[model samples]
Target: METFESLVRAEFTPKTTFLNTASNALLPARTVAALDRAARLRAEGGALDPLYADVEACRAAYARLAGVPVERVAAGASVALFTSLVAASLPPGAEVLTAEDDFTSVLNPFHARGDLKVRAVPLEQIAEAVRPGTALVAVSAAQSADGRIADLDALREAARQHGARTYVDFSQAAGWLPVDGDAFDYSVTITFKWLLGPHGAAFLVVPKDFGDLMPVQAGWVAGERPWESCYGPVADLARSARRFDSSPALFTYAGLRASLTLVEEIGIDTVRAHDLALADRFRAGLAELGHEPVPSPGSPIVSVPGLGRLQPELAEKGIAVSDRAGNLRASFHLYNTAADVDRLLDALSG
Candidate 1:
């Protein structure tokens, strides 16, 4: 397809037509077909063999896309953020350094714990904040609010100097940007956001050596060879990050697998190009409407300064955007087009 319109026409559902793919993507018909088939098998109470196979395939697909070994990939809810905290696993009262710009979900796991100390520093000061006592330096590869990409390489070097590990939350970056897990010792990602998968599915990548350090959580399925052991004491912590994952949610796995397969078929570079082009269009359109774009040449995210105050009016125009702390966020993705950007500009003009 030469344009986003063609791609959407071919791949998306007609009833859900819209370019707000950054919020929650409209799954392709093929994904829906696969999910339906999987659900049918589950409904019939047949062997759950296919579901397990799909889960493993999903893990492998996500690992390949992330440039990490399948053994190092872990699955869970908010897996990236949770895995980062788990990777820290520091002694009580030890501090974990992160940015104030991070999504609230990243902070929740650490905030809920009393023993672990979480420190939020400005993005500019993150490198300087990684001290000897800091166990991990966690940050997003791209800030979710405004789509500003982080300097992960610099953070990684600083963490290395202090003998601390780096954990990157790539939920907003994956699928739309290139990610090298080696940029940090660990990286967390959610399949839902940029990966365009179903909600409640995420992946965590831990460096090989740190895999065994993950503390086991509830559920017998988390045990090594769970099906093989009846009630035997859980022995031999898993040698890979799979040790951190509990039982697979088969329904979400089915959706995630289909989504990843679609992404792989589209290719990452192509997706990035589409996202950046749309972002540039959005920035240009916002500027024409007398609103300041948050940052020039922004990533998939663009902010219109005044839209935040006009949310109710904009919603009436059939446009969906977020008003966050005084900025209206327009997030671009593979499905957006220059026409969509123009439409948003026109809405803001009034």
Candidate 2:
């Protein structure tokens, strides 16, 4: 068994002090190798059995990570697709309560439908704002711009009291913060960021009874017997949440299988501890330098107000981060270290 330190050393060889996992994650060497192998297999007309197997493996892995039964997990290409499906399922005048500054994908689907009455509230007020008329409470588990952790327990309790369903996006939370998919009526996550997977994969978790979704974008892959139903309407839609699945992204899933393997082996609890320590170190450094970061306690992501202008300068210094809505955002992950955090702080201070 590889120790955590040994596993980190084996998987990563960074070219820079990478502190931007919130925007895009650095791929592990093993995942890159898997991508190369997938490309070669496709170019050589090799058997695609391995690629298909990777898809199922990823579905099962995500199910385990989200603490849901495999039957409730539906594979998709993006969070938007899943959100839109949920939007389409709602009644014409249903009300959706959301965080005003939540990720656009989470908010747009409800608004675009034109018929739903969408209401936006401040993140802190989400739970208090839920009412009996609200049909769904949609928000990210972590704010994308500033990394403020949502009070999911409070929101869930309020939603239940109001008889409103919950749709939580775990895209920014899953790899480091432990998630419970069964806690919400629905949840969506993209695999590229914290999960350290390729770009073409996302996941949606529906309730065990499949909830109220209509499978508006269902393809042959949503059929109970996909290959057999290819040229016609599906003989029968999947009895499970697989009915919501888009066709699997085979090559992307092939690489994700390797990435997710690393995550499971390392354990989310271990990753969270390592990431938060580095993030807090950076926060302490920012305070010493007379800068105040957005308060995001217990989160690996830190956003410093009035520091967005330093992004380009730090990038030139080989320290990666993001400038989001005028805040300098840095996200720490299992691969980062005290040295990496110090390097970024040093660059900023200088």
Candidate 3:
């Protein structure tokens, strides 16, 4: 197995502990270079259309990472907007199911519409809630608050049995967990969390059969030919999942593609292994500090007691972490090491 130490070491800083990758991963040098390249190209002011190729490349990368076909992936700015778009696509009177406290990105979209019946149940009880008439079942691949990994395989199976479409927000799981696109009909992820890309870069994957489903929010980029003046007879749309995409900035596409190139080079399986090992260390160490961590196998997020109380203090010491539901959340990505966790533990103890 090739070690990723050098690759990870080169991308980020050593002084600060960035445990809040789940909030937003630090942009790598490669991503910055990509943004700069795009900026230079934009300054030239000729043929802005070719930059759309970057959007396609970004979508293709997400497709491969999600184990889905290129046609299933759509680029977007954020998961919340895409999730809401999918919710809006559902027919009126549709019933949407999710965990009672699933991420706002997962539940808020359905609830905000007030047209569909949104049922928020316990994670364990979600599958049982599925019915033949259920329109959609959306949940996070891993809980953001305390690193609770959902049983997606089982959930998808149950949803399939009930003829329900399954949706997963993989913002927290994409780089670490393999979200099976063949099983789930729809999935979305913001790459900044786990894929180590820029903010405002995200993807939504839809089933190939969804070509007939009109987009609830489509910008000019989603048209058959964005450069052409879309006059009368607006019948033709993107044949691929691109139809659902909004206009992501050119830099967003470039940044996502660049970071994804590094992610692919290091390899997803290796990153997953490294991240889990660090999380395991963090969880064990937190327990030794007399604080129980939320147990979430295969997830990089480890929840500790007094996280919110400690967040400001830890930040003062250049240790970055995020708080969720009153728990300290230390999220480990490929860049984190055991020393980082030790620093957090030491800070809490002192």
Best by lDDT: 2
Candidate 2: clashing residue pairs, number: 0
**Per-residue CA lDDT of candidate 3, range 1-350, in tens?**
44588877787764689899888888888888888888888888767665688888888888888788898888888889888888778887899889978889888878888888888888878888888888889999888888888887788888989888888888988887876777788888888888988888788888887722578676676777765515544356788888888887788888888899989999888989999999888777777878787778778888876558788888899999987778888898888888887888899878
Candidate 2, residues 50-161, lDDT tens digits: the string is: 9988988999999999998999999999999999999998999999999988999999989999999999999999999999899999999999999999999999999999
Model 2, runs deviating above 4 Å: none
Return the clash pairs for model 2, or none. Answer: none
Q: Which stretches of candidate 3 lie over 4 Å from their true place?
A: 44-46
TM-score of each: 0.91, 0.99, 0.94
lDDT of 2 at 208: 86
> In order, what lDDT does every prediction score?
0.74, 0.94, 0.83
lDDT of 2: 0.94
What is the descending lDDT order? 2, 3, 1
Candidate order, TM-score descending: 2, 3, 1
Which numbered prediction scores highest in TM-score against the true structure?
2
Candidate number that wins on lDDT, 1 or 2: 2
For residue 46, give model 2's deviation from the true position in Å.
1.2
The Cα error of candidate 1 at residue 92, in Å, is 1.5
